[model samples]
Target: MSEAQNPNATLSVAILSGKGGVGKTNLALNLSYALFRAGHRILLMDFDVGLANVDVLLGLSPEKNLQDLFRPDVTAEEVVLAVEPGGFDFLPAASGVPEMLEMDDDMREVLFHKLNKVFGSYDYLMLDLGAGISQTILSVAAMSQLRVLVVTPEPTSLTDSYAVIKVLHTQYGITDFHIIVNQVEGPADTQATFTRLSTACNHFLGFEPILLGGVRSDPALPAAVRRQIPLLRHAPRSPAAQDIVNGAVKLHRVRQQRQQALVDAPVLGKIPIIRK
Candidate 1:
């Protein structure tokens, strides 16, 4: 599972939103399960730093979290938590890890190298980032090859999403961004929200944000979260579950097309597999 052996490395994507309580973690949790069901080796990373709850959502409690990796002598392998049944592994970020705000230069290098060394093993490494645009969280978001900006129909959500795109453009100089409208009442509502966000990004951010699609607001989401199970398994026939599957398919196709384009292009200048 080392980088050298994994030539067809997994595509790293971080799910981020400008504000909290917009179903960011819900999307990340179910999306990982959807990808796993689609037969890809997936790794769901809880990179929430101070307040990670991916474990609670999944209904599993591990004695070890990412804190183990930060210890003086623990190896990288010691921190990975394997989720049962789905075969998708995870790197959990629980509460009270020392230096949670920022990883020092040495720690950053070690983490980057460890990720590079192991990321090639899977087809997708999905990071569930914390809400808000903190320096640490935003840095992690920018590092990913792809980003999923989740938003609702709320005015605050739209405003915060704009702020996130602005930060990404100014701080990381990233132009490739995708939008996913969540918690919509219906297709019309989804369109309205998407249009507003897209117009703002194009007019002000100087970039066109592609619509990655939307997930209709479903009552089953919170219920599943309470039960600590993926919505796909808890309510497979639900509208939201089906939408998640559709989203996963779209995302998978996008990644495949990008890879194929890289392969077909004769120049092959620099493949942007991961941003960094």
Candidate 2:
């Protein structure tokens, strides 16, 4: 397969968290939007299968979702929708489906087979993964080229985020964690929060995660969410939105570096994938 049909060029980035209410999904959505605005072909996959809400956040009602992709007749291209106003491809997941939550290895193989067909088409595959460490999430995070750990300033948030980092590092030797401190007060607060997490990682894991950037606490962020609008689209000038846009700029450069490295390096194996 050429780069368009394989994983050689496309950069898969999974934005994840250790716990809920840390604004993982929201940042995933906006950062993808910001990158799209920055002239990249982005495909934002809502991997929070059972409780998926990317569609709800974007105010989209897709006729086909990730659930439909599992059906033999349904293709990822068929289910993937073009996000309006934001102008990126979106692969939405089913919400409140019990069986989708308890996905087995067989089901995952089916999903990987389906997704592999479309992975090569985008410049960046922004995966909004489910919170906490599950088998499926662990595998996905491990396989992704970039694992973005979104954390807040709270002690519990840092603790849980460290737990995630430790698990992924121990299991798969994933050391390139890009940390983004969301809802921060300012640069000082962001540094403080990152220092705390970095200290823990350096002391225990012998690695420190890169501080990508921080999203300051902005009321417009929640308002955008409430109104079902992308923060970039809603209030691009807002503090949180600007922070995300800045992060996207840094992310774009990193992605270009990684993509070239992937092309020059060996190809990733077919899924079910993990242990990178």
- For TM-score, the strongest prediction is 2
Candidate 1's displacement at residue 164, Å, is 0.7
Q: Per-candidate TM vs. native?
A: 0.89, 0.92
Please provide, for model 2 over 42-70, each residue's C-alpha lDDT reduced to its tens digit, 9 standing for 90 to 100.
Answer: 88999997579999998898888888877
* lDDT minimum window of 10 residues, candidate 1: 263-272
User: Candidate 2: deviation at residue 55, Å?
Assistant: 0.6
Residue pairs clashing in model 2 are none
Which ranges of candidate 2 are over 4 A from the true structure? 1-7, 85-87, 264-276
> What's model 1's TM-score?
0.89
**Error of model 2, residue 188, in angstroms:** 0.4
What lDDT, from 0 to 1, does candidate 1 have?
0.79
